[model samples]
Target: MAPSATAHPLRGREQGNLPEDVSSFVGRSFEVKETRRLLSESRLVTLTGLGGVGKTRLALRVARDAQRTFTDGTWFVDLSELHDADQLAQAVASTLGLQDWSVRSPQSVLIDHLADRRTLLLLDNCEHLVGPVAALVQTLLRACLGLSVLATSREPLGIGGETVVRVPPLTVSAEPARAPAPADVPGGDAVALFEQRARAAVPGFRLTAENSATVARICARLEGLPLPIELAAARLRALSVDQLLERLDDRLRLLTRGDRTTPSRQQTLRLCIDWSYDLCTDREQRLWARLSVFAGSVALDAIEGVVADDGVDGDLLDVVTSLVDKSILIREEVDAAVRYRMLDTLREYGRQRLRDEGDPIALRRRHRDWYEDLVLRAQRDWIGSRQVERVSKLESEQSNLREAMEFCLGDPPSAASAMRIAAGLYEFWIVRGRFKEGRNWLDRALADGGPPTVERGEAMCVDSVLAALQQDTPAATVSAEEARQVAGRRLGPGRADTGDAAAVARR
Candidate 1:
């Protein structure tokens, strides 16, 4: 066979120019200038934001643009695939396109080479492996003044002198003009971007007077977030602009399938997240869905309580830790422990999946039981010899426990469980310093009662603490007295009767 026309002079270099992977980035001019300014002055410039906001694209653009400023060509290391921090330096060495270094650690070798040389290092997707990434960046900056790094992530490296730039979503244009009188609304980088991408899919797909307003409106609703807009634009083959708009109220459903022709993960904006979830095993998936119950971050012990099915097979901590490694869950380090979170976007996606997969009554019952058991344990432990230790443990789990209690009392599974969970966590409130949370739980347990008299009375005692915490003397007096009345009621000498008496006033 003769040499083909598609063949290049250099083998691998030809394929590197593909648009989806990394090329001369087309848009993102505003980010380029800020990145350049940071790279020139700071030891480290970390570009941070929600995923798919185009951090890697912007970083590459900055690196290519700044290559001439350094004698050493820019080095790029992508860390998304690396879960363990130990691999950080090896990955960096390989990405510098470095080959011969068997004598020492790759990082040491790279540092030795970097000592006398000046280069721009572009580290992409560092959020998943931040601890290792931060340590390495700090080490490099201390040992070598000649090196500059442009890192992209969902959060910042805590290396001192690190300049953090948050990448905001793309700008949107005026609403799409689907009406007879076309309005001229102003547009931004995101609007111009949507038109450019749409045109790529269909010839002559420009923003004309006929549909310009509606186009802008669509972009704005999607938050001018590039990945979603691109996914939306790619769907033009199957649906009209109007149809896309009509269906977007449920964005997860509307945006599942994407331009298979696009890229593997970025095919659909939703699929970007779906890929992360698909990468998890069954336990991880269940943990992720249950994690949606938390609106903000929660501690590991809390997760362990709510999701006891953790281990190599169903270990809660290990599963959550893996999700954190995969960047599906983000951790905020404070004191000695790590607090973990799912993004608002991701949390919503998990919630939708939970609703689809879980039985509502059953889920609520578990919610009630988990917190009920947890608070009972905390209360018992708090009254034990290790009161301080018990209080700290309860405090750690307070947020999720509070969430479960509120879930129980608000529209709880059974009024019986609701009353008990609220009454249970009430002592946890005093111990955990969650006065407001406990009071809220107590109030709901009482106000929404179809609960038994003993449960309701125990709930009153719980409210007394809440009222006392807030300096509401009248309510405190009322609830304490109410508790005494229920507690003093004589037992009927049966197990059931004793159960009511026990609830009315704990031993």
Candidate 2:
């Protein structure tokens, strides 16, 4: 196939079917430029990402931006509405304004109609019909010179020479260097998008000095994904920023207002994730749900440790890579370790599946066990020159650790595990100045009533020291006495370490 420039120019007005976007378009300036460059070189360019990361919008905007360049026409065919692969070619033919009456196939009609015309077809939502779409695109490009196809899907079309652009979430400021002024708002596409939709939902809504940080927080929590941000911003008509943040824990339920004109699968945050979720293989589906056990970006080993089980059988890395290919997981390189993460929206959706199909409690317990082993390893490493590295690792794994600890505390048999984990990380708590948080976990674990094992004694010792650090001397004294009694009973009659534990607690 030749570049769009070499095709014959049509006599009539350019025959195009690109739809006009009713709402505003935000971000993807770089994506638009790169896509246009690729379209100039390749017959097919696919924009792939999670369902609501704005692939369709970016494809449309890019098509519109490059339409004038295609003299014959630029057209859009939304395959999202077409269910069967058999109906795919018909959909394309109709989009191209061709009505076939002869014995020729729709595919033949499309090829013959655009044989010499310089045309671009923007095919949206191809994941559901990847095989048919790939075949159609491959056939059309081979037969019709000067034809280009831009496709959007949850994964790549996997055809030879297909230029795949993985669309990313909108930009978010992870941490502001300082307090941001109104000037900073425009640069963060995620915040800018939130502000735009908020204004639409509530006429006077604006990101103010007081709420700018909150708005950024909201975006960060949503991982800067566009659909969630749009749904969140729309809630401003009824909920404040603080309220929205509070309700984000159940975001799938909270973020239900999608544009009425959009396909029904995109009508809510849950439906958007559901559409993607349904496309996965059984192993992929089970792994996706189990991976919700992670707190943030997960190292490959961590994923294997947590997700590999009897029911979910496969090479863990292959399953994970498949998820990445399907845009369910985002792979990140942090330090020297490769990690993968899901957007919170997807994570919540997966967590719900974990609850439905499998044992969330068992999975969470496994999650807790993995983190417990991790903390112990970090504790050993912290005593050496790798202390800084260990600290950074601890910080990175903080969310997962917290999740694990919470899991342990919530289950009776796991209280001992929580106590052991809390006791093992006393050094981390003290160095990081998280005495109160450590104390709270320790207190709750002890309150849950585990046996007076050595782990419990150690936890009591750490709790006493934490109480002392918080200036609660009476509570410190009481805890110190309890620690001494438990240690003496558990560790034998005259262990000097028991005295040391009590003295450290008092001091």
Candidate 3:
């Protein structure tokens, strides 16, 4: 319900160009109502959240619903593909069907045209050129009393009097305790969204008891985010729910299908995260790649220790803060300690960048070194009054420790470090009932056949202990004998190999 661009006989047909919704709008009734309320109270309302969180869709929906309030009509301008800030005003002007050939600036033209109209302008995807967009919006609002602007951005435009409404991912139901009939399932908005898209992708697809739980798992795994859910649902045309859920570990590659009419950046999960990545500064991008070494939420101290380097030149805190503002990094306060994390999709994208453009080996080695240091410190303090704190720290960093150990084991030269780390965690593994996991790491590291060293000897001894605990006497005896032989020889220095140079992509 947008005003027509054709000049009305009285005031020219309501002058607006809001695109029609191609697909059904999913649930966000609360968000829609809140955004509309803010629109009424303020001249400027910005919808902000992570990319692909349905800001544009919600904005468009609200615009359509509130069109009757604006006698002059509602207009939508998409800035996703517009990279040049210089063309920001021109883009809005062109979208409004402006045909002025005069030398006056587009801002002047827009101000003159909208001065007397009770118009609603919906600016979609304004995060990239937020500064320029903010300046323009301020100018237009000051010149036009009746104009109201609703913008969608990953971050807020920091202009005075701007109201920010964060659009969170759709609410998703917890895993059902028991599978029920489709009608009995109380799947939330995320399930409803997936069902709708899945039906379109595969005709007659229904939420039967057999697949309902899998569907719920799929939505939960996707964190109830809409774009990922939609992309995942599309795979139902070619994959079963179980298959789709199993393949979601590599979601960036698996969810590559999308509508052809949409922008290329939005056509896949990787590309969507890639769009956000591209908006970051060079240093910020480097930090993003380095931070990918983490498995889950990370404290600021951990990031500073592992990610800060001469390659990423800047105040690490500032860069981290910038990423948070841009929605590339999510900040949280857990137990009164600040931490940050990237979305799984964003982490995958950063990992790909690290492999393809950045020095993956160096960054990962630094990551390993940091975690290794933590493990060593924890071992030294395990027998004291801080034993509980040590245990808590080790438990919290378990995933990071695993990632570091995996990296060391994979790289031949770092096999000794891997053995050392595994040996150091022997008590932790035993206490945590991770006997099999400890043995697995030791086996992989010993299989690398590195030079005789105390580290390797320790690893073999620990492997023997774990094997004996598991009642594998044969393997335990072999490891114990190997440990004795390794201890008898002098350790040699490891040779380092240069990693291959990765080609950088031109911006």
Using TM-score as the measure, the top candidate is 2
True-structure RMSD, every candidate: 20.9, 27.5, 26.8
lDDT of 1 at 382: 57
* Candidate 2 vs. true structure, TM-score: 0.50
Q: What residue pairs clash in candidate 3, if any at all?
A: 7-12, 7-13, 8-12, 8-13
lDDT of each: 0.63, 0.74, 0.74
Cα-based TM-score, every candidate? 0.47, 0.50, 0.49
Q: Sorted by lDDT, highest first, which candidate order results?
A: 2, 3, 1
lDDT of 1 by residue, 22-134 (tens): 21234567789878987888979999887678787787777777878876557676565454465467656644544321224656766876776777788877887888889
Give the TM-score comparing model 3 with the true structure, all chains together: 0.49
| Candidate 2 residue-wise lDDT, 1-507, digit = tens | 101211122234357867556467877778889999998988899999876788988999999988887888898876654544765786576556453333345677778878888888999888889998999999999999889899999999999989999998888877631334444564378888888788777888877777877888777766677876775675576679888877664444444443333223334445436645765789888888888878767888887787777367768888888777555777776677777877655776788888887567877888888989988888776788889788768767766776788778668888788988888888887665555457767887888555668888878888887776665667778888887778777777777265544665566
Quote the lDDT for 293 in model 2. 78
Where in model 2 is the C-alpha error above 4 Å?
Answer: 1-271, 491-497
**Candidate 1 displacement at residue 283 in angstroms:** 24
Which ten contiguous residues of candidate 2 have the minimum total lDDT? 1-10
lDDT over C-alpha atoms for residue 172 of model 2? 85
Off by over 4 Å in 1: 1-26, 174-186, 250-507
lDDT by residue (tens digit), candidate 3, 1-507: 112222212224355777656467888889999989999999999998876778888999999988989888798987755555766787676557554433356678788888888999999888888999999999999999999999998899999999999888888778642344444347777887888788877879888778888888777767777877766676676689998777664444445443233323344445435545665789988888888889767888889898777377668999998777555677776556677877655776788888898457877888888888888888877788888667657766766787788788678777778988888897787665455557767888889676777787778888877776655567777787677667655433232211110000000
